[model samples]
Target: MNLVIVGLGAIGGSFAMRLMKQGYDRIVGVDIDEETLQLALDKGYIHEGTTSPEHVIAEADIVLLTLYPGQIASFIDENKDHFKQGAVITDVTGVKTSLIRDVERLLPDHVDFIFAHPMRGSEKKGIAGAEESKFKEANALITPVSSNKEENIKKVEQLYKDAGFKTITRVMPEQHDEQIAYVSQLMHALSVSVVNSTQASPDTLLFAGNSFKELTRIADINEELWAELFSMNKDALLDSITCFEEQLDVFKNALVNTNEEELKDFLKKARLQRKKWY
Candidate 1:
């Protein structure tokens, strides 16, 4: 099976290496960045490299687009004509509702555009940081449209399983994005805000506890990519942020009013709610 991965960064390069190791021969990589393409090839993640999306689509049986938010549709529309017949295509984009509708509308009838969001990533970037085991035990959410074939969905499930991921299928694109905004995007925003809010000096840094360190772990995020994701899913994220702010306001009010009973009640309820979360 010929598989081509576009945007050979951390996720793409790691997936390519794992699939290659699984005995999937005929692997190709396409990336606009020559340096990244050369790095993936040098690391043996790809058998060959192509700077042109058209060339990769022409020969690949399956294509994985790992581009940034809003970039996938343009690539698909530009090269849909070159995609091999019956080829199964998938994406590793973080947000689903952001593009799935438009992508489904534009893709050729013969090609399958199964949407997937593997719930795993790192603060690091590039093929140099890629590791095959990164997908292990990671939760993969597959969002398939109506036109998606059952067989094609199964193929994607097996591919993730072989790469050491545990997969679950979520049919609707909007549902996928809504869930991701809460779990992934909200957490990143919280971390970034927490870290930025604390303009601590060197002396204050020495006083940081383990809890503070853990809470702000994801604050060192990739700004460029994450900014795009936040912008694309603006409404959902804004709602989440607004809800969080309201909760914070309640806490602030309780503190200012010196309402011990209310504060205790709030803490108890928060503990109970957190206990129910997985």
Candidate 2:
């Protein structure tokens, strides 16, 4: 199948490489950056590369949108007419509610847009940072609206399976947003706060342990991309933050009151819950 990957950044580029390794050649890449497109070609992640969506979108059997939420909607709105009839379009966008609503409304009837988010990534950006191993044994969430065709949804599920994801889950768009707000967005927010809480000296960082480094790894984020994600899912993210703050308050009170039992209970509960997660 001919595939078109929009936005040749880390996620997109990694998808391209994995798909190529699976013997699905004829992959084309689209990006605003000419340098990135050339790099994708040089790395053999794509057989063809173009700076304009209109140039290669029509020929794609599957169009994988790996751009930010806002950019994905805009690209679909502007180039929906060029999409091949019966072509399946999927995305790697983090947030989905507003994006799905907008793109589905503007999408032509001949083409289908099935929203999917691969639950894997690094704290790095661009094609240079793309790694095929990121998708190995990772979970993927496929969010399909009521209007989505059943066949198209299955095709998207298979797409992720072929890309090396270990698990593929199906969820409604709003439910996906709510869950991701807690599991994904909240962690990024916490990481940013932890990194910014103090202006640590280089020597201080040198003395840090694995826990500190792991917790703050995502703090080195892409501001422009994450800003869009945080804003688009503001309500859910804020709710997660409020819930987190309430839990933190309990710990604060326990420490302030010198309640050893309460502190132990909190730590014990956390360890038990985390055990269930693993």
Cα lDDT computed for each candidate against the true fold: 0.85, 0.90
Off by over 4 Å in 1: none
lDDT of 1 by residue, 133-236 (tens): 88988888898888889899888888788778976666577887777788889999988887777575667658899988888899988899999899888888
- Lowest-lDDT window of 10 residues in candidate 1? 196-205
Clashing pairs counted in every model: 0, 0
Query: Which digits, one per residue and each the tens of the lDDT, describe model 2 over residues 1-278?
Result: 88999988889989999998988858999999999999889889899999887868889989999988888877888997899889999999899998887887788889988999999966788987798776999999999887789999998898898889999999988998999999999999999988877676668688899999899889999999999999999999999999999999999999999999999999999999999999
Give TM per candidate. 0.94, 0.96
- By TM-score, the best candidate is 2
**All candidates: CA RMSD in angstroms?**
1.7, 1.3
Clashes by residue pair, model 1: none
Cα shift from native, residue 98, model 2 (Å): 1.6
Model 2 worst lDDT run, 10 consecutive residues: 196-205
